[model samples]
Target chain A: MSDDKAGASPAAAYLAIDWGTTNRRVYVMAADGSVLATARDDRGIKSVEAGCWADELAGIRARFGDLPAIAAGMVGSTRGWREIPYVIAPAGVTELATGIGRIPEERFFIVPGVAYDTPDHADVMRGEEVQAVGACLSGLAPHDALFCQPGTHNKWIGLKDARITSVTTALTGELFALLRDHSILAEMMTGPVEDGPAFRAGIADAAGGDLLSRLFGVRASVLLGRRAREDGAAYTSGLLIGADVAAREVAGRLVHILSDPNLGPLYAVAIEAFGGTSTAIDGQAAFVAGIHHIWSMIDD
Target chain B: MSDDKAGASPAAAYLAIDWGTTNRRVYVMAADGSVLATARDDRGIKSVEAGCWADELAGIRARFGDLPAIAAGMVGSTRGWREIPYVIAPAGVTELATGIGRIPEERFFIVPGVAYDTPDHADVMRGEEVQAVGACLSGLAPHDALFCQPGTHNKWIGLKDARITSVTTALTGELFALLRDHSILAEMMTGPVEDGPAFRAGIADAAGGDLLSRLFGVRASVLLGRRAREDGAAYTSGLLIGADVAAREVAGRLVHILSDPNLGPLYAVAIEAFGGTSTAIDGQAAFVAGIHHIWSMIDD
Candidate 1:
C-alpha cells in the first residue's frame, strides 16, 4: 500500500499533509505536481491528544498507498509529534524543508509555521504564511508583496523578498458574529441578511470619523427611525465589518493575497477607504504552491 | 392633592418627577428650588407599558401622599395619557414641554418630549431628553455641545445655545448586556469584570481599528493564544463602547461634552478617542440638575 509505487514506480509520488489542531488534510502528488488523489480526517492534533499522527497518516496511506507523507501545523507544536519550533516571520520556505521528516533522513518535508514574538505580543501562522508566499509566486510577482488572507482570523502579512517579515491579524468575521448574535444590536437584527441598506449605511457611518458617536446612530437610526429593526442584524454586522475594513490598511499599492473573491468585498471596502491597490488570490492554491516551493527548496 | 394653591402662592411646594421607561424618581422641591425630599420606584413606563401610565402614576403618588405630580415618558406616548407630539429638533425647552397641565386656574407643568422629522429619518426623546437639555442649560456652557449619557441605552444629544436641539441613541449599554448574557462570548467570560488589564485591553483592541475586526479578535485571540477567553466580555464591551464613542465627532476644536464619570474608564476613553474639552459629571447629581432645569422651564 505504498503510494510511492501506487501508479507505477517508486519515484512517482510525494505526499503533503496540512495537519492542525482541529483537522487534517493530505494530498498525494505525482512527479509533475498533479494531485494523484486526496485524503481528509477529523483526527486533528487537538482531538487526537494521544499519539495518533502515525495512525492518521497510516490511514491516509492505506487509502492512497504509502508515500513520503510530509506534514504541517500543530503536528510540530511542543505537544505535537515532534516539536518543530515555528520559523521566525522573516524565514522562508527554506526553513519549511530544513529539518522536516517523519524521522530524519526520510524523503518528507514538514512545513514550519511562522511565529512572531515581540515584547508586547506573540502570534503564529500555522500553514497560510507559506501559502501566501506561494501565492505571490503564483501571480508572478516579485519576491516581496503584501499578503491578505481573510477568514475567522484575517492576516495581513508583509512579505519582503519572499520572506514573511511581519504580520497583523484581524478578527473581522468573529466580530460580526458577536455583534449580531450577542449585542442589543441582536434585538434589532433578524437572520440571513435580507437588506443591505444598513450594511451600506454602516460602511458610510464608519468612513470618516468618530467611532462611538457614529455608533450611537446604529441604535438611534433604528429607534429614531433611521433603519428598521430587521435590518438591525445586517446593520450591526456591517458596523463591525465596516469598522474592521475601515481600520485596516488594505489599500496601498500592493498585491493583496486574499483567500477568495467572497472576501473581495471586504478588501474592496478597504481599497475604497484607503485608496490602495489590491489583488485577490486563492488560499488553497497558494497552499499547493507553497508545498511545491518547499519541495523545491528541499530538493535543491 | 393640589399644588394649585402652592403654584399660586410663592410658598407652595411643588413636585418634579423624572419618570422614565424603566425607573421612576420623584423630587419634592421648595418654591426656592431646594430639594426637600427624594424617592424612587420601579414603576417607570417600561414596567407597565404605555396604556397603564395613569395607574402607574397614581401608584407612585400613593407611595408619597396625594401631591401634584408632573410625569414624563410613555405617559405622554400614545400609550400613556396623551400623545404629546414631538417638537422639532432645535425647538426650545418650551417645545419639548408636553402634557403641561394646571388645575382650572392654577399653575403646574408636565415636561414635554421632543421629536424631529427628516426626509430619511425621524427621532423622539422623552423624559431624559428634558433632563439632558436641562443639564445643558444648568451645567454647561451657553453654546452648542454634545451630552453623553451612558446606561442601558446611551444617548448622544446635541444642544444649541443651551437648548436640546437634537438627540441620538447608542445601545452600547444594552449591547454590553446582550453580548455578556446571551452570546457565546459569555461562556469564555464566566466571571466578574477585572476592569484592569482585560478591560483596558478591550479598549485598546477596539480602539486599534475597525470594530468588527476587533470584535473577531475576542474569540480568535482566545482560540489563537493572543487573548485570554475570560477577558472576552470586557473586550467585547470595550469594542462596542469604543465603537459607540468613535461614531460621532471626537476631533477638531469645538467638540466639548458633559459625560457621566461612573462609567469606569470610558470617560477618559471618550476624551482620548474623541479629543476636545470634556467634563466627566456625576450622573446622580445631573439627575437633580436635570429635574431642576426642567421644572424651572415650567410656565407658571
Candidate 2:
C-alpha cells in the first residue's frame, strides 16, 4: 500500500541543505513543513570551488527539483561560499532568521551561526545552532534548559526563555580521535568502544580529577596487567565523556541532548552517570524542524 | 686553560646510556661519578632491528672504548633488548640498584623503571625514575617533597627520606604536540610559545576546571576575534601545564622541577602560579648523578 497522502502530493517547498565541511545533507520539505524526500552526499562546502557554488546549488536543485534553497553550517562560514555574521546569544529562531545572509541571485539563503562572547571568554558554532533552535521550537527541549550536542566539538548550550543563553564547547571527540591515532596510547586503544564495565569505570575515574594523568593511566593500567588492552578505547571514551559531563553543574537537572544515533545514547548514559537525567533528540530531525520554523517566518 | 684535569685521563668506568625510543644520550663517567665524556645520537632502541641489540651495542662500543654499559628508559621495555620489571614506589637508589636487570654478557646492566600501583590506580615511568633518584642522591632535591619532571610524559613524583613515595604521570607535552600538529587548533598555534600574557592566561584559565572545554576555547577565542592567533600555542601550553599543576596538591610547598632548560623554567612558573614555589634542576645532571649513585651501590 502506498503510504503517501491519499490525494496529490503536497507542493514542494524550499530545499534545506545542511552543508558542512566534508558532507552535506539535503532535505525536501513540503509547504506544510513535512519532509518529502532527503539525500546525503560527500560534496560538502569544501568540495565546491569558491566560484562554483552556483553550479553546485544548481546540481543539487536539478536532482531535488528547482526549489529555492536554504543552507546552514559551514556554508555560511568564512571558508564557505559567502561569509555570514554570527548572531550573538540570547538569540532564538527570530534573531537567527533576521541574521540570515542571502546570495546576490536572491534564490539561496544561508543561516548565520551563533556566538557567545564575553570579555574573558568566547565561543562560536555554525551548524549546531540551527539544530539547537529547532529542538527548542519543536518543544523537544524546554524554554529554559541545558542541551548537550556531542560531536567532534561537543557543545553544552544553555537556553533561557526559548533563547540560547550560553555556549560551552569541549574538545572531547577531537581529542579522543587524536589520541587514538597519534598518541603513545594509540596502539593499545585499537579496540571497539562500547557502553560496558570499562566505560563506566572510566567515567568513575574521571571524578577523581586529573584527565591528563588518567589518560596516561590507560596505557599504564594495561602495561601493569590490571586492565585489558582492548578496553583502553572504551575506558578513554568514558573518561573524556565523563569529564565533559562532570565539568558541568548537572546535579539533579534534566539535559536535552541533540545528536546522531551513535553519540546520542552515549551522551545520555554519561549524563545519567553524572547524576543528571537526559532525553535524546534526533539531530537531523531537529535541524530540519529548525529550518522549517525559520522558513515559515521568512517565506511568508 | 685546559678544562680537563692535568693528569692522565681518568680510567673509563661504566658508560651510562639514557636510551629512549628515538634518541640516546651516553655519558662516560669516572669511578667518582664525574662525567669524562658525553655524546648523543639517534640510534635509539626503535632504530635497532630486533635481535640485533648485540651488534647495536658493539657499534656503540666501537665509537667509545669497550666499557661496561648501564642503560635506562625504553631500553628495558618489552620491545627493547630485554623487558625489565618495574620496581614499586617507596623505592630509592638502593631498590633501583637491586632491581637492575643485566644482559647475558654481564657487562651490560639496565635500570628498572618505577611503578606506583594501587588497587584503583596505576602509573609507570622509565628514564624519569633514574633522574628523580639522582636528584635526591645529588642533594638537588629534598627527600620529603614534590618533584615535577616535565617532558613528553610529565611526572610528578613524591619523595620521602630519599625514597620515591608516589608517582603521577600527565600527558601534557605529548598532548600539546599532538594538538599543535593535528587538532583543529593547529592552524592558529603556529607561532612560538614563550612565557607571556597568553601563556599565563591559559594557566589561569585552567584553574576554572573543564579542561576539554578550555581547550576548545583556545580555538573559539581566536575565531571570535577575542584572542590573537599567534598566542594560541602559548595559551594552550599554559592551559595544559596549568591543568597538570592544579591537579596536584601544591598549594604552599616547594616543588623540585627536573627538566631541560626549555621546560624547566616553564614548569617552575606554572607551579608558582598555582601557589607553589619551585626550584629547577638540570635534567642531564640529575640523570648522570642518579646513574652514578646506582652504579656506586651495584658495582661495589
Candidate 3:
C-alpha cells in the first residue's frame, strides 16, 4: 500500500501550498523545478471555517491563477480542509505520493501526514515529513541521517535509507511560550534569548538533569539576586533546548538540522556543547524540494 | 542573623493566618497552642492591594476581635502586605521569629521566608518553610528528612537537624494546568487525572528520559488511536510527577509528602514506582503547628 509506481511527469506549473496551523507558505513552481513566485500569509488552514475551504482555495487561485495544486500540513488534518490518513513508517516519497488524497471535483491534492507507531509508543507529524524527505532529496543530508526540525513542536527524525524510521517531537517552543506568556517565570524574563554565557550555563545545568527544578531556578535566581533578570529568557531557552538534545544519543553523532535562522544556531550550539557535531540545512529550501519531488512523481 | 533567641510567650489569644497568593486560611488560636476556630477564604495576599493591606487586616480583625495576627506565606513577600526580607537557611523557628517584620502601626507581624542561595543555584519559599519545620515539630517527619510539598509550584526541601538546608521547586501543577487549559494537548484531556495504568505507563515512559518528547507523545499516542483520550490527563500527570521523582535520589529513601488529598497519592505512587518510600503528613496540620511554634517563641 505504501509503494505505488511513479507516473509520467506533468509539463505544467503547479501551486505548492505548505498550509500550517498559523501560517501558510505558497510556492509557484515551474515544471523545470524553479520557483517562479512565493508568498506567505496568515491565512493558514486553521483560519478557514469548515465550509469555507473552497473559498479559501479560490482566493489562492485568484491570486496565482488556477493551476493544479498540492497542499500539505494541517490543511490535510482532521481539522483542516480535508482529512488525509497518515502514511505509516518506514515511509518515503513513494509511500507519501501513494497516500495522497484528492479534493472532490477539484484539481487539488493533499500530501498525507506520517505516523510512527509501535506496540508501546506512537508519534505523528504533518508538514515536517515533507521537509525531512526533501532535505534528503536535495542532497543537504544523506539518505541515512538524523534531522532536527525546530519549531513550536521540535521534531527529531531518524532517517534510514531515504525512509523516515522514527520521529520524536519535543514541546520546547510551546512550553517556552507558555512559561513566558502566562506563568510566574514571565515576570523575570524581560530580555530576549541569546546564545551566550547564561544560556550555556543553563545547558551545563541541564546536564545535571531535573528540568522542573532547574526551570524554577530561573525565577529563584533572579529573586534572590544570584542571577541577572535579563538573562532569564536565554537561560530558559538553553535549559529547554539542552534538555531536548541531552535526551538523544548525540555524543558522537552528526545531526542535520532543518534550520530556522534564529533557532537553528541555538540547537547547533546546544548539540556541540553536548558533544555532537551538526550542519544546518535551510528548512524552506527542503520543503520546496520535497513538494517539487512529490509533484514530479504525481500521476498526470 | 538567623539565630535570634526565643522571647517570653504572650498571654493573649491571636490569629494565625496562612496567607498564600490565592487563598487564606485563618486559625483563631488560644494561648495554649490550641485552635479555637478556623476559617478559609479566597482573600489571599494577591487579592489585596498594597496600600489597602491595612484595611484588609482591619476587616479580618473586625471579625476576629482586633487580636494580634501572625501571617505567613506571600503576605511577607514584596507583593504581599509588606516586604519582609528573606532569612537565609539553615533557619528554624527562632530565626523566623527574629526575622519577623511588623506591619506599620499595627499588631500584625509577617514571618520572613527562607532563601537557600549557593554559587550556582538559588531557591526561596514563603509559607512552606513553616510547613516543613512544622512537619518535624509535629512528629510527622524526622529532623533530617526529604519533604515534597506539592502544588502549583511543588517544593522539594531537605531538612537537616530540624533546619531547612535546601529547597528545589518544580512547576508541575502550573505546567499541567497550562497544558490542560491552553495547549493543543488540552483538547485530548477531557477527563480527570487518576493513579491508574495509563498513568503508570507514562511513568514507565518517563523512566526512559527525554521529557519534552514524552510529553508530546501524550497527544501523538491518542491521535494514533494507540491510547484512550480519557487517559490523556492522567498520563500527563504521571509523566510530570515521574520526571520530578526521577530527578531526585529517591531510590531507597523515605520522602515525607505534605499531602493535598487529590495530588498527594499521585506523588506517592510516583515515588514508590521509582523505588522510594513515602509518608503523607497533613499540610494544614503542619501549617497550624508551625505557626503555633513560631507564635510561642515570639517576643511580646
TM-score of chain A considered alone, across all candidate predictions: 0.80, 0.94, 0.94
TM-score of 1: 0.72
Write one digit per residue (lDDT tens) for candidate 1, span A46-107: 77646675676566666665677677776776657777656766767776677454454444
i-RMSD per candidate, Å: 4.3, 0.7, 0.9
Residue B278 in candidate 1, Cα distance off native in Å = 4.0
The candidate scoring highest on TM-score is 2
Whole-model lDDT per candidate: 0.61, 0.87, 0.87
TM-score, chain A only, candidate 1, equals 0.80
**TM-score for chain B of all predictions:** 0.80, 0.94, 0.94
| Deviation in Å, model 2, residue A84 alpha carbon | 0.2
Q: Estimate each model's TM-score.
A: 0.72, 0.95, 0.94
**DockQ (Cα-based) per candidate?**
0.30, 0.89, 0.76
* Winner by lDDT between candidate 2 and candidate 1: 2
Stretches of candidate 2 exceeding 4 Å from the true structure: A1-10, B1-10
Which candidate leads the pack in DockQ? 2
Q: What fraction of correct interface contacts does each candidate retain?
A: 0.46, 0.94, 0.86
Q: List clash counts for every candidate, in order.
A: 31, 1, 0
Per-residue lDDT over A75-101 for candidate 3, one digit per residue giving the tens place of the 0 to 100 score: 999999889999999999989999998
Ranking by DockQ: 2, 3, 1
**Tens-digit per-residue lDDT, B98-187, candidate 1:** 345433222334566666556543456667665566565566434476776667667667778777666766666875675566554567
- Candidate 1 C-alpha error for residue B75, in Å: 7.9
Model 2, span B255-287: residue lDDT tens: 988766888888888889988999878788999
